[model samples]
Target chain A: MDLWVTEYQTPSLGFSCKISETLRVEQTKYQHLAVVNTDQFGKMLLLDGMIQTTEVDEFVYHEMITMVAINSHPNPKNVLIIGGGDGGTLREVVHHPLVENGTLVEIDDRVIQASKDFFPQLSLSFNNPKANVIVDDGIKFVKQHKDKFDVVIIDSTEPVGPAIQLFSKEFYTDVYNCLKADGIIIAQSESPFFNKDVIKMAYSGINNVFNTTKLYLASIPTYPSGLWSFTIGSKKHDPEKVVFSGDLDLKYYTSAIHQAAFMLPNFVKNIIT
Target chain B: MDLWVTEYQTPSLGFSCKISETLRVEQTKYQHLAVVNTDQFGKMLLLDGMIQTTEVDEFVYHEMITMVAINSHPNPKNVLIIGGGDGGTLREVVHHPLVENGTLVEIDDRVIQASKDFFPQLSLSFNNPKANVIVDDGIKFVKQHKDKFDVVIIDSTEPVGPAIQLFSKEFYTDVYNCLKADGIIIAQSESPFFNKDVIKMAYSGINNVFNTTKLYLASIPTYPSGLWSFTIGSKKHDPEKVVFSGDLDLKYYTSAIHQAAFMLPNFVKNIIT
Candidate 1:
């Protein structure tokens, strides 16, 4: 009667939730996938023994990742999401009336299939007529497209497994070329508390290819260190200077929170800047 | 050879750390206490199956609790900490050049004993000549003192068992009366993400007593939701408007973060306000 599912956030730190039953499990070509019904978090999607999304706190991660860049662009029409297999980022993107077209490139097909089966609320956007879903490598896809997207959002996992190349300078340069002259990109950099080196690497890598770059903080409890960071790189648009007055009917993101997220703590400031 | 220690952040959600060994376990008169050697968090202290402090992220909790109020008051010579049995707040207060004296009144001597024995870095200020360490009930102690201290900090546990009275409206009034005419009080308000009702209770209780009350946030991974909040009540000083230009050789607190901490997201703003 006491069934628990655990994610080892670090080599030693583990987070467990009580589970009513395991919904599905499969071995994808790229990673292992599992879906479970948890007593606390509702439903959870895990990839390779790590928490990818939870029903309870996924709103915080999805909203923070999509809205900041979408709202910052003056006219966000063409939006691109890289490696968001769960479709949460795409779900938030298609909410914008101005986003006429949105595309998602996820390498793992099983991750998407699992989400579509178990997380219908998040996978709603996959059926939108304005959306295009691709099962391909994001690094190669971005390199082939030039000056296409107004906003590029990377919703990849930790810099491990098949997604390791997404953090490279070369891949960022490709993303820079794939965006419009005034486009913006937001990638989930790891935590400053647990992954200082990854934060430094992502900031430094994105800084080399963009005209303007900024790093922001958000609290995502399911992640390794609940304190998570994101790097925003823009060709011309300054995310910190942009403002939004329209109603997005959001649960977390706001114009005030957009500015406040950039104000990092002293130790985190030392790492990025 | 798999050993696990679990802390139920809520009744349904659990956080576990792989343990190499359990250092100490004993039942105090007030609550149960345990010290464990965790692979991820180094040494950790637990009270009544809840995490009190961990060596890895204790800096975030201690620094946020002590430095904000100390720097806000122009001349913080005298300070009082209620229920900080671990001496972490006392240690941070002693770092200020303007703090001439500090007092800590903790209910259980056993918690202090556990801290001194396991958490030496945090318990470094127990023997400070300017500090007065009293083992007594904090609610009774504050009621007997009037216009005595420049700052009063309540670092008690959650509103359970003996500490439930500390979060009541009557107790906050006593804390207000214990301070000087232009004094400030800061209490560890629970997370708005998980403990919404508790946060509401603490915020509304403090708001009734102080002319200016503000809520701020910090990220401590071991705590529930990883997004922890604090409420500050002041007679005249606005915690939002205070300026600090000195260096405390701190790892976390800065003037920029001091400002950002008060900038709540729209959802949290709706809750506290």
Candidate 2:
């Protein structure tokens, strides 16, 4: 089939690149990796049927996922990240003033190593002394820990292969157990477009345990759909209340955007509802 | 050569999809127009080498671009859109209660016709009686008109091709002339990641013509970097003061986001400074 590509830029998608040639694909222990350079977004990397990163914009995703959950929790003392081996999430999490301790539990040691070697800016979050890099299964770690975290951020890959367990009800239940009473958790639920069923399932699963469940949206160029959704589960504090009250120093998430992010499109809303 | 795809979710980039397909040569017009159906974003369309849209997530882009610019302008009586023939911008433009006349100047009638046929929800904006669809070059139209618009939104394609003139100094000057003293113009710049140079250039270009120039960011899934940037140029109004005081109820843009949208990143700040 002669496939034609079209890029929607109304809202102004950041990086738009069209690839014209075969670059290179590297099969990693965790996922198959591929590298392609396009005319728009620059160098992009794909892993195990999912996009990992490109040389273009990387700040939006990392900031929203970390800031929303961290900022929502008034006192984020200890932070646990599940499967953010890229360290980008960790980097943003450490920026929070209240976060004293941060732990990244990733299943693939290679992902972390690869990110550190290749994408240095993303891996920069690990430079902080408080960030504890744990090369262990995030699910296993969550099972052992109980009420130890004030905030938990799930930066898992797609709901396939090793990352599939992160979307399970049992895992989220454990995640609920692993947080403090007033804790908050943000999970990178797949693109609201392609992964509607998965997002709905995850939201339903997380909603079963949490007091409040909110879905936030972000646009990632590398993802299957430009529109990406993140589900934030809070226990005590409401997302609406954790307003952007501080110095107002943010590139992505502002008080207005925080509220807007919660406003899901009708289709996504229908799926989750 | 073998091509590899990788997706990265950055702070500026909400999400990205990388494709690593083997290729022989790159086409000029459709370098980014490779369509791929994935487990996530549905039938993805690429053009000239960037993501256009899938059946999903088009609302996010439309809502964001139109809402922000429309809400920013106070009492937008006569609105002028430079590009955006798909009618997504027009749809959002006419939503303003005070918007008495809305004119869309698009070079590609095909895009408008195609969108009206393929994406009905987006094209619905043009169906309104208030909308005046002008199938002509936006650059020439703006140049011919003087002090004719309250708000001018440049929803053109990328800075390349037919839309390239919209980003030039002369076009911005014409846009400045076409608006009233208190007029506002919002232009879609490139991603801050890959298109920072272009964004910087456009920033400098717009700033040359308008007094109060602000660079804001948005996330759309179908774009290259997923981290979209919009530059707003005002003759007299401050974008920070731009609010949704109008009676039109909006799903996205709000007073808070309007103020927050002007908050520039350190990198962006460095360039503007």
Candidate 3:
């Protein structure tokens, strides 16, 4: 018998992985969550039938989301992560020695509980002395805080269910208010091949809210198309020109990769704007 | 009531596309061939249950394989493409204004016929006045002709069945002998994520015979990991230093991208060597 869990990346496309065992499954207040052990990718996490993160290639997504923004700012002291219950974004955020404090805002506590139980390697960052985890909606939390964060990272899921409001101009405007001057924000844009319209909307929406906006790319094999895009909105600094001064011994993020990620393919460039 | 064609990218991973219809399927003299019309990706061709090329993303593969070499060589008059039965490589090769003649040696005529019938956009270049289509084993064709070509492009399938010999050191040695002095050669090295061993072997094998060998990357949505790598073995010209001179209106490759393709992520750089 074959035990395979498949995600319909689109109505006409599917990506599957052979699972060794079903570790856990339950319906949280937000969405349906599942954690499974796979043959190739170790532990896997899924929400609403969409892959959220996997143990193997999760570093690529996490590094691109956090380190790029952390390195973009001259002195990143306070960092906020929105909707990253797996704690992977926080794990990458704390890598910068200049970060004095980090906060994570995730509405679903069950996801945090499940990840803490299943993915210890990623969830261990929650116990860091400088880290704070909160159970609240990200938009509401950001609206209450003004000029508090040096960098704000949105590590949410695809824009279908709870994440739909997160991609709007109002939400980005709120995030723009919560960040200090010269602060930068990075959000996960969907795949350009499978989610062209969403990516375009993201590109347009971010550009309207921030003074300087740029888009970058990374490869996440467990995602819809294995090609994922990220959008960065900066208030004053340009991510492309920011020099790297951090001493994070990273495995994926490099000074060259930071510049290379923003160089879009022509097909993607046509769709992104 | 629904039929889907799936490629087991590995023993534990599968990527599937919904097919409107199966246009044709046959066991040719070389390998199994199947052409299906996909809902989103248009037409896709498969060999031995692995995706050889898709109508949508074939341009990215073909352009990177040929234009990079054509632009690398200062003056490329004679070119050879091995095992590119679909003529997509030849299609991109003929775009160069400097090419005087091009030859495509394929072991199987059925794949060419199928491409001509199904993928007219890709196979139309077979009728170019400058192209010579020959159905023969490419290894023997290269061995018999030495110091005969300016650039050699190996556009074969993965290392399996009849095409496995094309990845050997002996094959690279023969290809080295068949090129003009200061000639260049490029071949498809599989994904660094899934086919790490194969890419490592190709890198070491090519470096042993050529003075400057480099590996580059592109994102193809239909492939195993969407991240694909290519190996270039040059006699004297460093592909990195050689600037792109062509003026073709391509949708993916750019002058900056030509240099940026070689700027790999740290993980892939570690794997290629």
TM of chain B, each: 0.98, 0.82, 0.98
User: How close to the true structure is residue B240 of candidate 3, measured as C-alpha lDDT?
Assistant: 74
List DockQ, one per candidate, in order. 0.75, 0.18, 0.81
Angstrom error at residue A24, model 1 = 1.3
| DockQ-based ranking | 3, 1, 2
Docking class of 3: high
Model 1 local distance difference test score: 0.89
When 2 and 3 are scored with DockQ, the better candidate is: 3
Candidate 1, which segments miss by more than 4 Å at Cα?
Answer: none
Span of 10 residues, lowest total lDDT, candidate 3 chain B: B240-249
Clashing pairs in model 1, backbone N/Cα/C closer than 3 A: none
Encode model 2's per-residue lDDT on B1-273: one tens digit a residue: 322233333222333333333222224332333444433344444455445565455655666666666676777799998877767778887877878999998776666655665566678878699999988878789889999998888876676666677778988998999999889888888777567777887899999999988888765655654567888888876776656665444444555555555555455566667
RMSD of each: 1.7, 7.0, 1.1
Candidate that scores best on DockQ: 3
Per-residue lDDT tens digits for candidate 1, residues B1-273, read 978889999777888888988988999889999999898888999999999999988989999998888889987899999999998999998878889999999999999998999899989999998888999999999999999999999998999977889889999999999999999999998887888888898899999999998899998988998999999999988787655677777888877777788878777888976
**What is the clash count for each candidate, in the order shown?**
0, 73, 0
Model 3: per-residue Cα lDDT over B141-255, one tens digit each: 9999989898999998999877889999999999999999989999999887899988988899999999999999888889888889999999988787655565778878877
lDDT of 3 by residue, A59-178 (tens): 899988988888878888999999999999888887678888999999999999988999987898998988999999999999999999989999999898879999999999999999
Q: Which candidate is the best by TM-score?
A: 3
